[model samples]
Target: MIFESSETSGFPVATPRAVPPSGRRPGWNKVPEVTVYFWTIKILCTTVGDTAADLLKEKAGLGLTGVSVLMSTVLAVVLAAQFRSTQYRAGVYWPTVALVSVVGTLAGDNLIDATGVTVETASSVFVIALAIVFVVWYRRERTLSIHSIDTTSRESFYWLAVLFAFALGTAAGDLVSQRLHLGYWLSAVLFGLAIAAVGLAHFQLDLDAVWSFWTVYILTRPLGASIGDYLSRPSGDGGLELGTVVTSALFLMVIVGLVVYLAATRVDVTDPEHTSRHVA
Candidate 1:
């Protein structure tokens, strides 16, 4: 994978071209460029996923099973639209990500609460599952870079990896905060530092760009979840007591505004030239 240092994130940004198998014409890339906005919206979606799930279960009184079914159904519909679209549309893409976040969080919760699985076991299982997805994806396509996510097969692998990342992140966050008793704010700090360390390793220590990107991506899930918890949990619980409803609404509004801006501007579309460059 070809990369250049990102001005915003300090980590290497992928600029690889995708080569479709012979006899296939390449299509428009189905995901955004790895711009600052991409990371911003991603973290926002993760935070929303963490709190919105709780809000639905408690305020809407849907309970865990009901919320899981409702959100999973919604995510399936959104993902269907995502798969059908010829290219990335901020409206369709971000909402699909947000829904996946919700479903992923619920999946982790069910595994722990209803099934009586320990957090460590759940985390380990998700890690193994994610590794398998990555192995299969890389073996088939010969690359794990998100820059090449143009075809349906690659897109399927991308979403599968994303789902497992979210699930693993939720389990890891819960394990640290609840089991280890680190509290929400401290957990957020820990994960944030972890992301920074990943960046430092990539930029200063010559880490592989693809591995660096995926590491930061997985770490962001727990970081955003911890931030959500820190903001929404009561003061006695070492939070600001903003409440999940307030936190979800506030973040959702910001996310909507940014998505609208991106839709109008088309600033996040992956450049076709970058793909061609890699192929050449």
Candidate 2:
């Protein structure tokens, strides 16, 4: 891995160069490498999160409060296991992310239902909160790259950022598709285009890699939610009518398959020696 800091913004910009993995160790880093598999599984997890929340709430008869408490407890437990581990295991790490997605969706739903908050307002607040987390994280750690998350404090910041991003994505997705009445398919298209533009800026126009990565990361949540809604909602509501259970099951199966393959292959493991040398 290689990165250079821009003097104007002080953000590390990754260069498209890497060393051969001569002495690399799997599970040395606390996060997976930013690869196609990572993004594919991430979007799947978000889609599952969106549909599963609805499944547990409506079909299971858990209601919003009950589902919130149940998922939050489970997330706390998984997160504890993640923190206790010294390195990244795909099993531990991906579960934590999936649970975070569920909890984050429930959080946004609970806040809106409980307080009658507008989706636009909730979206704005989450954006501010996420921005604050990044500011504090960068100030304390001097770099916001996932490759640099070798310490406990950095991991804490990373999770906090992830949680907020999920919440913000939920709110933003709702604002566009529900509140603004743009419809789910259109919302998905818009976010997908935005992610494509960000990719173009990063790969072809010299945008900072850290910014590109986080920008895509945040955008995927809304895109995935839109897709989940489009697939699972009733046909009367302009969806394919697969229902939440079917949609969640299909996406979860794909996610499990991918994670299992990645675990067996260890293709997404970061080279600690290379990361430490270049990430800062």
Candidate 3:
């Protein structure tokens, strides 16, 4: 997250730099390779995470803090297993994502409801933290491409960034809907459009891959949360009245099906040759 300010022939130049080098290595990709399927399942997981957490908190009688801790502990275990595996195993990777998504959402909830932090302040803090993580990650690894996530350190940074994005998204989403009173459906639509804008910028406007990935990452959290709220909240709360348990179960099934398919087929495996071409 270190910003480099230097004089280039007496002209000031500002360069954003990561602290850790990008850890360009040859092996299973550290970050999940991006694909339409990747995005599709990610949003699904986020929704599941949101609804499931809510159900656990309300129906299961675990308060917000208790549920957050439980999910965070589970996420840590899953992530540890994910890191231990040598290859990009979809089975390990996506479950870790789902657990972390739930934990991350709770983190934001704790910050606002438990601590009374303003959404604006929480969002701003998360942005700064994310920037710092990126700065350190890039400075050590030397690249920020997901295709280069081969080392342990870089993978750690990647997950930290992911965690922050989810938390940030929660706060930002709540800010728009609750504070600004935009309502669930409208907020979901807004974040959806924002995601589209990021895609357009990435594909057509030639945005940097690092920027595109992170931008979309943040947007996805709120988008997923919106979806979760829309499905699980009471009819009085603007949801479809499906209840959290049913919505969570439905999404979990879909996620399991997709993960099993990816694991069996290796559909999302990053092609080493294709990645090398991009680097070259």
Candidate 4:
């Protein structure tokens, strides 16, 4: 999601550097209900998502549109299951993210492959749409902090923002690699550096948490996609020859293991009363 100056909305906002509550639950927070483990596994999942989708289309003989529709339907079911849960459940949440990642990547891929829209144009459209969603969300709620995502509306907005981020990331990544001809490894390195810069800005420069989180979140998608492409694509195409099936299987196993661990440890629950402390 795009970041905007809070001053534009005329809302009474707290200082951006405010500390989050001490008693926050282990899970269920609006800030992407996963841990660093969540991020690690999420990147892995995205890699698998990209590779698996390609395999389905190229090897399984399902065309781009067919794979998109199939994965989108699966994603819909998983996302519905996620929304139905009243509290954070790692078992449900991570799989939902993985599925959505695949679906979102496929959506972007379809736009490029089927509709012939330039990645630059697709990136611009998604970025604008995500910005609008964020602006409307902030205007209505008076805050864009994920820590405050307790209500249905906030959660809905959160997931929608995530979906768009994945799509935007796909387009942006493709634009950099294909259109800009940067190559997969170089693009991956660039996005990794960008994420590190955002982290530095967040911790050292005291950037807004919500903005930092979303920015890094978007960067991770391309980073993951690059990694996936580098692993699965042939050497002639500037990638290793590992193949999509192996890459997907390996990443899926890692994601499942991490999600199971999170479920057992309860690492992502958020306490309702403590939500206010994170509003900045």
Clashes of each: 1, 0, 22, 8
Give model 3 RMSD, 1 decimal: 6.8
lDDT of 3 by residue, 1-280 (tens): 3333321121112233443335446546754557767888889988987887788788757788788878888888999899998868899999988888888888888888899989898888888888898899877776666666778887898889888888888888877887767767888899999988876875687666567667887888888888888888888888888888888999999999999999898767766665444443
For candidate 1, give the lDDT.
0.86
lDDT of 4 by residue, 1-280 (tens): 3233222111111223343334433235533343567578778877877888788888867788778888888888988888777677788888878887888798888878888988888899889988998999877655566655656777788788888899898988988887778888998999999988987876688687677778878889999999999998899999998999998988888888877887787655544443433343
lDDT of each: 0.86, 0.82, 0.77, 0.75
TM-score of each prediction: 0.93, 0.89, 0.88, 0.86
Ranking by lDDT: 1, 2, 3, 4
Those runs of model 4 whose alpha carbons end farther than 4 Å from true positions after fitting are 1-34, 271-280
Could you give me the TM-score of model 2 versus the true structure? 0.89
Candidate 3's displacement at residue 272, Å, is 2.3
* Model 1, span 44-120: residue lDDT tens: 99999999999999977888999999999999999999999988899999999999999999999999998999999
lDDT of 3 at 110: 88
Q: Evaluated with TM-score, which candidate comes out highest?
A: 1
